[model samples]
Target: MEELLRFGIVGCGSVAAFHAQAIENTSGAVLTACCSGNPQKARTFAAAHGARAFDTLEELLAGPVDAVCLCTPSGLHARQALEAMAAGKHVVVEKPMSLTLEDADRVLAAARQTGRKVCVISQLRFQPAVQAVRQALDAGAFGRLVCANLSMNYYRSEAYYQAGGWRGTWAMDGGGALMNQGIHGVDLLRWLMGPVTSIRASVLTRAHAIEVEDTAAALLEFENGAVGTLTGSTACHPGYPRRLEICGTEGSIVLVEDALVRWDLPIPCPVPVGEGANSGAADPNAIGAAGHTLQIANFVDAVRNGTPLLVDAQQGRQALEVVLGVYASGRTGRTWHPETP
Candidate 1:
C-alpha cells in the first residue's frame, strides 16, 4: 500500500467541503487538519471530517500534514500558496489561481524554488468530452480551425453575491462574471483554441450591484489564425448552461455545458457518445466531486513520483491572462494583447 499523504484544508468555507470530500475519496490521502479565520467554523468542519481545527495558518503549517489545499478567496490564493510552499508543503489551490498574472508567476516561482509540486484545480480539462475535443484539435480534424467561441452565461441571484462579503470585490473575488463564474470556460477556451493573440472587449455590471462587471464580451484572435468571440455573463436569467462552438473549413463542433451536444465533420471522428463528465452548468456548486477527486488523485501521483500535472501553477496563469486582457480592453475601449501593458 502507498503511504498516506496527509492534507490540511485552509479556508473552511463552502468550497472547502468539496476538497474535504475529495480527500476522503482519494486513496492515499487524508484530511488531517482544517484551518479558517473563524475558529468555530473550522472546529465545526473539523469535527465532521475527523480533522484537527486550527484558526491560524501558522498552526496548520506546524501540524502533521504533507500538503495543503487552499480554498481561500481569489485574492488570497497566491499568498497562501507561497506561504504554504515556504512551509515545505505541496500546495493545491482552487481556480483563477491568483487575481493577477504577476501573482500567478509568484506562486509558480515559489513552487519551483521549494521543489514542491503545485496543482491548480482545473478539473474540467479532464472531462471525457473535452478530451475528445483535444484529440480532434491534435489530429487536425478541424482542418485549420477558422473560428471558435466560448459562452459561460448563468444567473447568480442578487443574494448570492450579497451572501459573501468577498463575492464581488476586485481585491478578493477578482472580476465578477468572467473571473468568478465564467473562468472555467475561459480556461477551456484557451486550452482548446490555443494561445490568444489579441482581444477587444466590452464589460459591464448589468445586473448585480458589485465592484466588477457581471457581463463581458470579447473578440479573440488566436495565434493559429483563428478568430473567435467570447461572452461571459452572470446577469443572464433562467441560468443557461455554458456553450462552446468551434468551426473550421472541414467541420464544426458544439459543446453545451461541457457535453458534446453537436458534432459535425466529414472526417472519421471517433467521438465519445453520451453525456460529458462535467455538470458545472447552472449552479456553481452543483457539479460532481469526481473532477476534484481525479485531479487530487493525479496530484498525489505527481507528488509521489515527480510527475507533471496538466494544470500546473504556471498553466493556471493563461486563463487569468485572458480574463485580465478582456478587463483591460474594456477599460481602454481598445483591443488588448497580453504583450501590451
Candidate 2:
C-alpha cells in the first residue's frame, strides 16, 4: 500500500483554499494541519478541510506534517520555507519563491543543506497544451527559436488591495502585476525560451493606488540569442486573456490562457486546440484549482517515488531573477544582466 504524505499549510488566506483543495484532491496526499497569523482563520480553514489548526508556524512545524505548503505573503516564503526545511520537512512554495534573488538563494541553500525537496508552484506547466509545446520545442521541432512574447494583462480592484494590509506593499506582495499575477507567464517564457540574459524595463503604478507597479514592460534577451518582450498590467480594461507567442525559424505557436490557440508547425499538436478554458484575467478567483491539483499530485509523486520536480527551488529563483531584473532596470534605467541559471 502507498503511504500517505502528510501535509500542512501556512497562511489561511484566499490562496490557501486552493492549496487545501489541491491536497484534498491529490491521491496519497493529506492535509493534516494548517496555521495562520489569525488563529480563528486557521481554525476555520482547518475545520473546512478536516484538518487541525495551529496558531503559529512553529507549532505547525512541531506537528506530524511531512511537508509544508507555504501560501503566505510573498515576503514570508523564503523565511518560512527555510524554517520548515530546517525542521526536517519538505517544502512546496508559492510562486516567485522570494521577492529578491538573495532571499531565493537562501531558500535554495537551505534545501540543499537539509537534503529536502522544494517545489515551487508554477502549475500552468502541467497544462496538456503547454506540455505539448514544450515537447515540440525540446525535440527541435521549433528549429532555432527567434522571438517570444508574453502578455499578462490582469485586473485587481482597489478593494482587493485595500482588503489586505500586505497586498500592494513591496515588502510583502512583492512587485504588483508582474510578480503577483504575471509570474506564471514569466516562468513559462523562461522555460520555453531559455535563460534571460538581459532585460530593460519600465514600470508605473497606473490603476490602483498601490505601493508597487500596476503596469510594467520589459525587453528581454535570451541566452539563445532570442529577443522577447514582456508586458504586464493590472490596469487592462475588462482584462484580456494572457497570451504567449513563440516564433522560430521553422514554425510559430500561440497560447491564450493555457490553450494552444495556434499551431503553425508542420506536425499537428498532440493536444487539441482550445482545450483549456481557465483564466485569471478579470478575476483572480476564476483561475480554479485544476492546475494546483495537478501540481500537488506531481509533488506527491516526487516525494514518494524520488521523481524530479517540475519547478524546483533553483528554477523558482531563476524566475525571480527575471522579475527582479525588470524591477532593477525600471528603477535604474540600465540594462540589467541576469546571472545565468
Candidate 3:
C-alpha cells in the first residue's frame, strides 16, 4: 500500500477551509498541521479540522507533513512557497502565485533548486467541461482558433475591501478584480487559446475607493493571430456569471461558470453534461470545493507517483505574466508584450 501523504495548511482564512476539506476528501492524503497569523484562530481551525496548530510557518515545516498548502494572501505566496520548498516539502500555492514576475521567477528557481514539486491552484482546468474543450482543441476540433473572450463581472462592495485590509492594495491583493478575481479565467484562456503576443488595456477604480482598479478591459493578440478581449470588474452590480467564448474556423464554444453551455463544432465531440460549477460572482465564498478536491487529489498523486501537475509553477508564472501585461498596458496606455525570460 502507498504511504499516506501528510499535508499542512498555512494561512487559515476563508479559502483555507476549502483546502482542508479537499485534503479530507482526497485519498491517501491527511491534514496534519496548520498555521495562521492569529493564534486563537489557528487553534480553532486545528481543532475543527483535527490537526495541530502552529504559530509560524517554520514550525509547521518542521512537523511531519510532506506538503504545504498556502492559502495566504496573494503577496505572501512566493516567499512562503520558497521557504516550504527549501525545507524539502512540496507546495500547493493559491492563485496569482506572486505580485511580481520577478518573484514568480524566484519561486520557480527555488522549486528547481530544491527539487520540490510546486503546484499552483487553478482548479478550473479540472472541470469536466473544460477537459472536453481541451480535448477538442488538442484533436484539432477547434480549427485555427480565431478569437477568444473572457468576461468576469463580479461584485464586491466597498465593505469587502475594507474588511480585508489587503484586498485592494497592490502590495497584497495584487491588482483589484483582474488579478484577484479574473486570474482563473485569464489562466484558463491562455491555456486554451495559446500564447498571447501583445496586449492593450485600460484599468480604473470606478466603483470602489481602493488603491487598485475595480474595472479593467484589455485587447489581446495571440501568437496564432487570434484577437480577443478580456473584461473584469468587481463594481458590476447584480453580479453575473463569468463567461468564456472561444471561436475557431471550425466552430465555437461558450462556457459559463465552467459548464459547456454551447458547443458548435463540425466534428462530433462529446458534449459535457452536468450541473455548472459554482461561481463566486457576488460572494467570494460561493465557490464550491469540488475543483479544489480534484486538484488536491492530483497533487497527492503527483507527489506519490512521479506524475506531472496540471498546473505547475511555470504555468503559474505564465498566468502571472499575462496579468502583469494587462497592468503594464493599463499604466502606459499602450500595447504591452510579455517580457521573455
Candidate 4:
C-alpha cells in the first residue's frame, strides 16, 4: 500500500478545525502536526484531531511532514508559504493568496526555486455544480457565451469583524466582502467564464462600520467579448442565496446552494454532472471546510500521482487579480485591466 501522506497545519483557528477534520477523514493522509501562536488553541485543535501541536511554525516544520496547509490570515500567506517551501514541504494556502500580485508572484517563484508544489485553496472549484458548468462549457454547450451574473449576499456582524485581529483590515484581509467573503464566488465566476479583460467598479462600506467596503459591485468584460456583472455585500439583511448564472447563445445554467439545483440546457445530456452523485450534502457553515478538504485531497493526489491541482497557485493569483482589478477600478474611477501590473 502507498504510504499515508503526513500533513502539518500552520494556524489552528476556526478554519483549522475543518482542515483537521478533513485530514482525519481522508484516507492515505494523516494530520501529523499543527502550529499556532496560541499554545492552548493549538493543543486543543491537535488533541481533537489526534495530532501533535506546536507553538510555532518552526517547530512544526522540523517534524515529519510531507505538506503544510497555511490557514493563516490573508496577508501572512505569502510569508508562511515561503517558509514552508523553504522547509522542503509542499504547501496549500487559503485564498486571496496574497495581498498584492508581487507577493503572490514571490511565493510562486519560491515554490519553483525550491521544487515544491504550492496550491491555493479555492474549494468552490470542487463543487459538483461548478464541475457541471465547466464540463458543459468545455463541451460547447454554452456556445458563444454572452453574459454571466454572480451575486453573494451574506451578513457579517460587527463581532465577525472583531472576532480576529485580521478580519476587516485592508492590509491583512485584502478587501472587505469582495476579498474575504465573496472571493469564492468571484473565483468561480472567472473560472467558469474566462479571464476578465477589463472592469469598471464601485465599492463602499455601506453596512457595517468596517475599514473595508462591506458592499461592492463591478462590470466585467471578458477576453472572449462576454460581458458580466458581480455584486457582493455583507450589508443585506436576511441575505439571499449565493447564486451564479451563466448565459450563452446556446443556453443557460444556474447553481443555488452550491449545487446544480437549476440547469437548463438546449438539449438533454448524459449524467448531468454530479446529478445523483454524492459529494455529500451542502452545509453553509462547512462549505469552506468541505472545499478545503477536497482541495487538500486533490493536492495530495497530485503530488503522489502527478495529477494537476484543481486550483494551482498560479490560478489563485489570476483570481486575486480579478478581485484586485475591481478594487483598483473602483478606487481610480476607471476601467482596470488585469494584464496591467
- Taking the tens digit of each residue's C-alpha lDDT, what string does model 3 give over 82-182? 99998999999999899998899899999888889899999999988899999989989888989998999999988888987889998899899999999
lDDT of 2 by residue, 191-302 (tens): 9999888999999999898999999999999999999999999988888889999999999999998899999986778999864669889888888998999999989999
What TM-score quantifies how close candidate 2 is to the native fold?
A: 0.98
Scanning candidate 4 in windows of ten residues, the lowest lDDT window is 274-283
Q: Please give the RMSD of candidate 2 to the true structure.
A: 1.1
- What's each prediction's clash count? 0, 0, 0, 0
Residue 151, model 2: Cα distance from true site in angstroms: 0.6
Q: Candidate 1, residues 1-341: lDDT per residue as tens digits? A: 87899999999988898899989999889999999988999999999999999979989999999999999888899998988999999999998899988888898888879998998888888777778888888888889899988888888988889888999999999999999888888998999999999999999989889999999999999999999999988888867788899999888888876578878866554666555635554567887787788889899989888777988987888889999999999999999987854
* Model 3 bad stretches (over 4 Å): 273-277
Can you give the TM-score per candidate against the true fold? 0.96, 0.98, 0.98, 0.94
Residue lDDT tens for model 4, 1-341: 99999999999877777777778767788999998878998889888888898888999999989999888888899998988899999998888789899999999899789988889887878866677779989999888999999988777777778878888898789898889888888889988898899999999899787788999999999998999999988887756667788999988987764677556786664334333322212223545466667888898898898889888888998888998998999899999986655
Q: Cα lDDT of model 1 overall?
A: 0.88
The number of residue pairs in model 2 that clash at the backbone is 0
lDDT of each: 0.88, 0.92, 0.92, 0.83
Question: Of 1 and 2, which scores higher on lDDT?
Answer: 2
lDDT of 4 at 227: 98
Q: At residue 249, what lDDT does model 1 achieve?
A: 86
